[model samples]
Target: SFDVGGKEAPKVQLTKDGKEVKFTSVEGTRHVYSIAEVKPEHQGVYKLTAKNKTSSEETTVTLNVTGMYIIQ
Candidate 1:
């Protein structure tokens, strides 16, 4: 969840690897950005932006997917 810190809610968007990613809210809340599933293709840098008429703020995160094997 992210805090926009204002009386009015900010518009939010998410992008992965410089491309726009589709997201949904788990509930009817502005703080949640939900991706239905995670796959190998989903591994990349993700950016979240919150903007209003007056100002904007951004945050970024990296997702790395690794394989795990069971040894016999």
Candidate 2:
């Protein structure tokens, strides 16, 4: 996260089912680091939290997993 002013969403933390995920860097005043990686078990709601020193905002996305049941 950027510790500088005039920068909103200084850091974007991406998580999948309470686990970290990879994300590309967006335009920003300075360089930012990646949060982490999403584990295999992390299959569900994906939440993204962007925040600065001031206030913070949040967003979430749903992800459903499926399996194949082929009959012979």
Top model by lDDT, which number?
1
Local distance difference test, each candidate: 0.74, 0.60
Which residue pairs collide in model 2, if any? 20-37
TM-score of 2: 0.54
Off by over 4 Å in 2: 1-6, 24-42, 67-72
In angstroms, give how far residue 37 of model 1 lies from its true place: 5.3
Worst 10 residues of 2 by lDDT: 1-10
After TM-score superposition, the amount by which residue 61's alpha carbon in candidate 1 deviates from its true location, in angstroms, is 0.7
Best prediction by TM-score: 1
Each candidate structure's TM-score, on Cα atoms with residue i matched to residue i, is: 0.73, 0.54
lDDT per residue for candidate 2 within 1-70, as digits (tens), equals 3323344545667777788776555454443444365444545787777677887777777755466579
Candidate 1 colliding pairs, count: 0
